[model samples]
Target: MKTILAILAGATLALAATAAPAQTLKSVKDRGELLCGVSKGLQGFSAPDASGKWTGFDVDVCRALAAAIFNDPNKVSFVPLTADERFPALKDGKIDVLSRNSTWTLEREAKLGLLFTAINYYDGQGFLVRDARKVTSALELDKSKVCVQAGTTAESTTKDYFAANSMALELVTLPTSGDLVKAYEDGKCDTITTDVSQLYALRLTMAKPADHIVLPDVISKEPLGPVVRQGDDQWFNLVKWTIFAMINAEELGVATNTLDAAVKSQKPEVKRLVGTEGNYGEQLGVSNDFVVRIVKAVGNYGESFERNVGAASKLGIPRGINQLWSMGGILYAPPVR
Candidate 1:
């Protein structure tokens, strides 16, 4: 009898452990809003407008997730976090998802106990320098003082690149991107270093946007993506597929204006995505029309890209590696079927 009781107790403990991680979905549903972490203000990526309404690339992801779960894209509370505060907020459950422009690295996942959902934006580290310097390459910035945000991979990457290239570097680390911008604009640093996509955003904030130019050298690959806490497979899968759905929708030629036609699409893939065929969304613990909700709310991935960070926006960053694989870029997604 004693042995049987011990076995039963152990089984119950195992079951509890399995169920613990799945609580994120239920918790989110009960709260009726998705708490999304974002940068304080990164212009085209994640920032508030004049009316205090958030709008940007990262903000759309949070809205898409909300639409998938609640069928209302606006059912999201954006929590702006600095570089140092992002991970802690996510780990402590202050935010359901980290939609900030954070890079994916081995240390972040293994050491920090976080899971990067997917690379929503393919980026590379580059330098931004005043055009007056006439510097066209990162190699030209030897011995230059670079402003970088503290607690970001950019800081280490800058150090590594400078050291590896046998060049001297003076790093001015600030607690936030805003501070980094100020330091650079105030002439405290000769150059500013970060992902090239971010350089465009930062340049726009300068006193003279056209006076600074992004260098041609991409020192490191920084695949920026959404992140979530580890140990919650259910929650992780939801976010992962939410991004994938947008990408897949774009691949299928679906867009916000074309959503009605997509609903009537006779293609097998379209049928599956629009919930006329298999119940893929239901398998992921959402309504069968989850993709439809996302598309209606945020449009497809391509639409979001063009609207927020691509040619349609002020950044005007080209869709180089971010283009769909069929169009010579590598933005491919798994099939819904």
Candidate 2:
């Protein structure tokens, strides 16, 4: 009887230890800025302009987080990381969150001790070839050299795709996105493969963007989003809901331009979202007007998409399935209430 009681007490203590609240939110508040990991330099996703001001879809996610926590969008220090360096950096406490266009996968979450907040961008793997090659389909690239970033899902996905189709492949794996682009541009490889959105962004860096084309064939589902380390439920919830709030704001037609009107809306959902009706933000460890701060900083998800990589921007990628659920896409978020 004594032994059984001791074992039961040990089990309870272990469970309590495992369920301890994560200190990431408090750490960010103490540090006075968020340490955000981003891609080395993926245009329209996370890149610094000539002025060194970071602006892109991924960059805006971190900025919105900063706004939600500090009420200042600029309270974030962007740390550029390569495909191989991203996870280790986040796992080692080098960054508070990673928003570098990383694909959310089971292995990454379970094996790497990381957690993806939400699918901020729905993407798929695709091929990019110079128009001069006249390659209209990825299936035609048999025996061709493919340039892909090493340590990325693209590397493995490309290999599996070719093997599955019984096509010959000569893969030129590089260490960074820039290296892959340079290799392709220098004729070291016949084509490059990555997320379709990245292909579009990379094309803009070429000498003649019009000379490259992203093939219509999509090979893999790449649900990209911000990632936080595991064991920090508080931080995870904050990050997850920050994205959800932006998505929900878009669905509710509460963009930055319409945010003031949303605050005055009598609708229960809008009131809860704008923090006039409930303590949802308090529940998340942020100010009651957290959603408003996010919208004011980065606008809604659609607004950020349009401004960075969508039709309104140079990338000109269509909304396609990234559109709001009610607007014919899969982008749906839970209500604030």
Candidate 1 stretches with Cα past 4 Å from truth are 1-8, 11-15
Number of clashes in every candidate structure?
0, 0
**All candidates: CA RMSD (Å):** 1.4, 1.3
Compose the digit string of candidate 2's lDDT tens values, residues 1-337: 9999999999999999998977999999999999999998998999999999999999999999999999999999999999999999999999999999999999999999899999999999999998988988888999999999988899889989999999999999999988988999899998999999999999999999999899999999999999999998889999999999999998888998898899999998899998999899999999999999999999999999999999999999999999998989999888888
**Ten-residue stretch with the least lDDT total in model 1:** 17-26
| lDDT on C-alpha atoms for all candidate structures | 0.93, 0.94
lDDT of 1 by residue, 44-123 (tens): 99999999999999999999999999999999999999999999999998999999999999999999999999999999
Which parts of model 2 are misplaced by more than 4 Å? 1-11
Per-model TM against the reference: 0.97, 0.97
